[model samples]
Target: MTELQDTGLRRRADDAAPSITDLIDEETVQSIAQEAWSALVGEDEFLVPLPGDLPEDAVSSWVDVRGPWNGTVVITTGRSTAEQLSRELLKEHAPPVLDEEDIEDGLGELANVVGGNVKAVLPGPSALGLPVVGDAPVAGPDTCRVDLLWRGQSLTISVQGTAGALLDQ
Candidate 1:
């Protein structure tokens, strides 16, 4: 191949993949935190990693993207935190009171709102699955976690929820 062609190939190789720092860079974290906090808790604060004591009843909502970029974004929070959110968000409803069903709904909405905001900045048109709630932290491959603390309550958001093909991507 000609020198010009070789140089072009080398440049492409150099820029072939996203760096680790670039993957979970400040911009991505800050932006997601901004959108999620504003939608859920009214504002965003200094977000830190998972604390020593993570609250129980933590729920996670995730969506799987199957195109150019593949992975999932899962939003998590304590059950109590979710309850507070239940009251806060449910105010828009007619009665403004939450029940067991409402808590599930609230969890979905929490995941949707947070995931939607994150999805907006992500690549494009990927299948965002329904939010999933459980007793433990959701784990996946190549995940970048953004745990949160709001009003003395702790919450978390897990990016990249595929154990097999997560970290590499």
Candidate 2:
């Protein structure tokens, strides 16, 4: 091969694959979560950035983003926290007793909004999948997570690469 071609190849090889840190930071993630919280969970509700112990019965909701960056935006919180959040989202419309489905749907929509905003900041032209609620996927190497507290309840938001580390382009 010509020396010019070899040099071009080397340059491409030197570029590292994009990780979560390369695209967004924890502060940015926290900001995105805060926006979602203020919009949906009530204008008065705010997410504190302090780290806290998550309850054993924590529940998670997430949405997948596929494109230059492939990962899931996951939101996790304790069961009672989730219920309170759902009620807050519904405001006076919430029933006297919140059911499991209500909690899941409310949290799922929160994930959708946060994930959509998160996707906008990432290397884009990406597609966002519907939100899923349950256990969160195990965090991978190229992951960005933010610990938060709402009403003094522990919650977390994680952006994890589904395909592990991104390989060189």
Candidate 3:
């Protein structure tokens, strides 16, 4: 009879991919957003934990986080709300009439700030990608989403793993 060798390596389960839910929770995400808003938008600005209907012309800004768990942090709201946010972000520097570029830049900055904070809370040594503005990426099963209202306007924040990340696991 031959003795079997003891290999230290262990097999990983097929569903071993880390999910957003496992890394962070909705309340944490909301807190992060609230802090970002207070700093960028205004000290008195608040993000109410409530759901509202998103308008037809909804826009999104997002940043990708790459690390042990890869995913995107996205913020979505109506175009009008975005414009209002841009104005608030600009504050004293805001022009009477904001152009498209202004709106996009403001929204992108908000995403970058929120995404950076989210990245800090996750398992790191993670790299944060530059913010992108457009339609939001489709969220996967491994996601933590938060619905919020700012000034009674609908807004949402989602931390979701990419489809490729899920497939690679």
lDDT of 2 by residue, 52-165 (tens): 999999999999888877788899999899899899999999999999999999999999999999888765488899989998766455477889989999999988875434
lDDT of each: 0.56, 0.82, 0.84
Pairs of colliding residues, candidate 2: none
Q: Which stretches of model 3 miss by more than 4 angstroms? A: 1-19, 162-169
Q: Candidate 2's C-alpha lDDT?
A: 0.82
TM-score of each: 0.67, 0.83, 0.83
Candidate 1 Cα errors over 4 Å, as ranges: 1-15, 19-23, 43-52, 92-97, 136-139, 162-169
Q: Write model 1 residue lDDT over 103-136, tens digit each, in one string.
A: 7667667667666655554433555666655554
How close to the true structure is residue 64 of candidate 1, measured as C-alpha lDDT?
Answer: 55
Clashing pairs in 3: none
User: What's the TM for model 2?
Assistant: 0.83
